[model samples]
Target: MIELQFSPEVANARATGSPLVALESTIITHGMPYPQNVETARAVEAEIRAAGAVPATIAVIDGQILVGLTEDQLEALGQTTDVAKLSRADLAVCVASGGTGATTVAATMIVAHLAGIRVFATGGIGGVHRGWETSLDISADLLELAQTPVTVVAAGAKAILDIPATLEVLETNGVPVIAVGQDDMPAFWSRSSGLRAPLRLDTGAEIARAADTRLALGLPGGQLVANPIPEDAEIPRDVIEPVIAEALSLAQTQGVSGKDVTPFLLDRVFHATEGASLAANIALVLNNARLGAAIAIATTT
Candidate 1:
């Protein structure tokens, strides 16, 4: 048996048939430290609400699919330790064992789609790790986007990955990577990756229309909307590139690989930039939430 618990806010949205955007809980559980993580989660949810949509921050708690978490739930999840980081392979096991888990981008999409939600907002989509051919350390997020029909709005793959390779894999899988308001892809904390985007969509309506067209044509997967970080909040490619290089070097030195690589690099970069990275992360996620709400509203009409 499975249970679905909704926060009061989300329950009302469901009853009203209002647009709701799915948010991943990993940012709270794994992205930052306690109060800040909880604070950021609420802010992101508020951004969605203020933009005229509901936010369903998905997680699995004691075998239940928690579609929306309350303030207390967010605090507990943020402060709790040993929560499993879930993906497609482990999602069922976590549920079966009655374990608490944070939903990654892939896992969140699966949960949201099952709940009939069509859009998700997240900080970034994971991708092929640098030097991936040896370790084959690709993030399940890419595969999820290739198979799931839930539209994802993100700042782009975390710049910690091999951006070009990530783009190639998405292309090979026929996933539409649309850069919102720019010709180039946004590099998570940075405004540009210095690589041309495969497609460009100016407004949330265009992105939503594209998603609807895909379903109408029997397309199998969803869209990757690469919404850019605001200029004032961006770290700028030039200034941030060296910091990333340093972080990657430290990761290699410490033998960090596979699932640990991203978080390790992110922490290192956060320290290197003196907290600039974390600020940019918060900015991009809030921005994506705004755009995601717009897309969710469009899907209903």
Candidate 2:
């Protein structure tokens, strides 16, 4: 049997049958710099707690899959260099080989299910990358959502992806994309994507009800709750579109492709926007955390 470990807080939460939300660790190790990453991780966890749920930040450390992390562990993971960027393909390998790694969305969902936690919150989901026709590079997050039973709350697919194609793939996979409080799907940094969402939910209770209904009807997969960024915090689509185009152009000129494309474009956009994009990212993540916690509470009760 695979030995899984939980931090003291998470263990207690699980024992008492309290609501819990799983968080991915890639934002701490791979998405940002040391102190800010650590700070953001703590803030997101606190958001969940304040909303009446426990936070379980998933990671693989020294062959153990951690369902939650202490402050020191969080700090150590943020400061450590060259930690593996783990997804569905390598999660088991990291555990078996005693490797240290941060869980991406796909890996996080798997771990969350194993821990019996049914909800997760993140800044955004990975999706069909631009130029996927030739490169055929798609994120495992899409497929994971189609199979994993956990409910994921996010702003939406990362703004850097081809949103329409991502929606098409989700539809093809029979995954439901439900926008919260809006008719249009959300872009990561923006409140609306201009494309109609497959469904719209007005409240966390409604989202929780949908999840329960899916299980009652024997649905095969989980749902994607596309929570929009807070209106005051958004960068607005009109302002961000040209910026994204410019960033993508620069990334191609720099010969950045495959996994490197996302980080490269994000960095360029961060610089171009004078750090507004990062601020927007942080806001959306916290917003999702609050909503995720509410859904977890409702689902468990």
Candidate 3:
């Protein structure tokens, strides 16, 4: 049995049967610098709380899976260097080795299911990378969605990825990609990907019913709730595409691969956009957090 250490707040929430949303930790460790990382994390948790749900930020430390973290834990995690960025492939290995690791989207879903939390909020899910045909490099996040029974609320797949190919993979895997309040799937940092979503649901209640129906039907996978970034916060695709292109080229030239590719690309995009990308990222994550909280509440109702 895997050992789970739930923080006091999360333990109380669980015992009281309150709605809970699982949050991934890689955003703190791999997505940004220390003080800002912790600040953004706390803001997200506060958003969830304001929206009537508890946020459970999942991580692994000393071979134990942490369902939630305290303020001190969050601060320490944000400042800690060389933390393993864990996904399905290496989650167990890290745990077995007693390593401290930040859970990525895939790892968070796995741990959320174990913790009996059914909803998660993230900035974006990783998907088929650009040049996937040559590199055949796909993120474990896509596969995790196809198997884990946790409803994931993300802005969409990261705009840096091949959006069309990622959508195709999700369709092929029979994962429902539901765009919230829109027909066009969202592109991270932008409101539209120019690709029609396979499904559309306008409200948290509608999404909750869909998730519950899947559970009743014994469906094996979860649903992807593609929440668009707020209009005021979005960087238009036209302005961001060239920036992404430059960043992608830089990444290719640098030979950044595997797990390192995402953070590297994001960092380049951040610099290229003069930190606008990070600001947009934080906005989208908070947006997703509110929706995640609503979905968690709707699930109970």
Best by lDDT: 3
62-97, model 3: which lDDT tens digit per residue? 788999999989999999999999999999999999
**TM-scores for the candidates:** 0.98, 0.98, 0.99
Between the candidate structures 1 and 3, which one is better when assessed by TM-score? 3
Q: Per lDDT, what order, best first?
A: 3, 1, 2
lDDT of 2 by residue, 235-291 (tens): 999999899999988877888887688888888899999999999999999999999
lDDT of 3: 0.95
Per-model lDDT: 0.93, 0.92, 0.95
Higher-lDDT candidate of 1 and 3: 3
TM-score for model 2? Answer: 0.98
Give candidate 2 misplaced runs (Cα > 4 Å). Answer: none
